[model samples]
Target: MDEQLMLVENLDMCFSTGKGNITALHNLSFDVKKGEFLAIVGPSGCGKSTLINILAGILRPTGGKVVLDGEEVREISPKMGMVFQKYAAFPWMTVRQNISYGPRIARKPKSEIEKITNHYSSMVGLEAYEHLYPKELSGGMSKRVDIARAYANQPEVLLMDEPFGALDDITKKQMQTELLNIWGQENKTVIFITHDLEEAIFLADRILVLRRPKEDQNSLNFIQPVPFSRPREPELRTCGEFVRLKAELSEVMLK
Candidate 1:
């Protein structure tokens, strides 16, 4: 079977500012393999969020194209799901209602929707809170609802933009493990955006490093493959290989 699932070619994004055009991304190109966990890390203002938005079809790029599943993407597709840094749960919807919103929109069978809601709620540890509204949930619990909602949609590729960035250190760590567990079970291709090098190394099969483009030069973006074996434990973060990889990524980020 072919490993590659998505192709990004010569991607570029430029904005019209008062001072003139501001280029957020230039000639960025890469491929995401089927079921691969790909993390994107970069310096601030390096187009990390912009890139994810374009991939999600939330924004249009000035140049280049994204091809997924052998077709060019020009607009939003049900095949792509997104989980943002901020909690995206509907304020008025109960946990069960929120998680099942996507499938319900697609007019899935009532039985299937119920099953999906139950499955992802349990997967994200929200089964106990399924009947509660967003106002009654903690930030962590709300974020769990966001994730479950995304997975419930059953997208071929999941796009995450710093989903745990606002959580406390303990909660962030817990979410990371939970995300990995969900990924293992779902076997979906994931494109995760984060500023945390350790988080990227911990969760990604390969890490893509992006640099801001200069007026006269094209910033070279590169990908680094993570070497750790699957089912990695939290203790792996303290190991020598993990440290070395993190150090290497840090240098890449700075350069």
Candidate 2:
């Protein structure tokens, strides 16, 4: 088994709203292995987005802490990268500029920034569109820019919150394939947030399910493992085993 890369222990989050204190997560704990692709799924109001934000260090939990590679994540760190559901590219910047933004902010050498830009733009098949601004690109192309930018940052882990949730079905499928190809080549640990069970099963090594908190109930539903082999193709979606797993997860999701 891969060594553990992140530890979430006894996490708890509460909000002070106009109504009063409301808990979002309660005593949630899990471990993500190094280079593992872990998908998180749950219905609306289940705190999937909140968990992603906590992992990205964008929010501080009311209790517990996230330990990444042995150190606690107290605030936003350079070691983590995120891709949001909407296209996160800057409208004013061209593809090359957007991809190089992180390295530039870090004050990397000009040559290194240029190299990083070229490599990631090419990786996302955006070399031809490198000079185009986000406004001129298609939705899928814009998303490619977002992915390339996040990867070029060279973060230890990638936290994606429904990055493909806004694309049309066809484009979403294409991006999913491209994402898998990138993951295969890079071997970076990923924590993906999605409501789609099919998408979760298709891309993740393991699925962590959460439930809406009610009263004193915990937020965790269960964690399911994906046993499929790698280099998986779209045809796998039609196979008996894949369909069975999807059905099982659907049952769990609807409960």
Candidate 3:
């Protein structure tokens, strides 16, 4: 097997409330290999988003550690990029500007920024709309812009928290195809979080099923490998193997 690119060791998260402390994640541990796509699926309160936040260094875990490339991660690292559930585009910025934001902040030369912005915009099929503001784009288009913006930075590890959850079924499927293509070309390690079991199976090389934080100290219920061949086709969703895995995952979630 490939050496682990990222490791989560006995991670825990707690938040204080008026009533008392609330545990959002409990002793969760996992490893992600370089260039692999991993999906996290669970019930609504199962700490999926909380786990992403911890990995991104947006929230410090109460216990345990995150190690990336053999070093413990204490804060946000340039090697990571995040795409939130919500459309994170700036309304005031044009698509080009939004995609170029990261490179600009990193003090990249204007020529380099323009080159990356153009490449990613075209990759996400947003070249024609590069000059358009966020308000003018549809939900699907806005999501594409968000993806383009993330890729523009060329982070080695990409974290997506229910990125396509808000799109319509048709649009979501299209975006999934687009995402897979981008993932293939970029070759970055990806950790995707979603509540949809089918979507998880369709996109991940491995699926991590999380349990509600209150249910157990070991929040990770299981880690199942996806057996489908790469460059998966839409037809694979109806195949027997895919159906069986989905059924198994559904049962696990409901239990």
**By TM-score, who's the top model here?**
2
lDDT of 2 by residue, 1-255 (tens): 389999999889999999998888888899999999999999888888789889989899999999999999988887888898888999999999999999999999999999989999999999999999999999999999999999999999999989999999999989999999999998899899999888999999999999988777788889999999998898888999999999988887788
Poorest stretch of ten by lDDT in candidate 2 = 212-221
Clashes of 2: 0
In model 2, pairs of residues that clash are none
Stronger candidate by TM-score (2 vs 3):
2
lDDT of 3 by residue, 117-163 (tens): 99999999999998999999999999999998988988878999999
lDDT of 2: 0.92
lDDT of 1 by residue, 97-168 (tens): 999999999999999999989999999989999899999999999999999999999998999999999999
RMSD each, Å? 1.3, 1.1, 1.5
- lDDT to native, each model: 0.91, 0.92, 0.91
Q: Kindly give the number of clashing pairs for every candidate.
A: 0, 0, 0
> After superposition, which runs of candidate 1 have C-alpha atoms over 4 Å from their true positions?
215-220
What RMSD does model 2 have?
A: 1.1
Better of 1 and 2 by TM-score: 2
Model 1 score (lDDT):
0.91
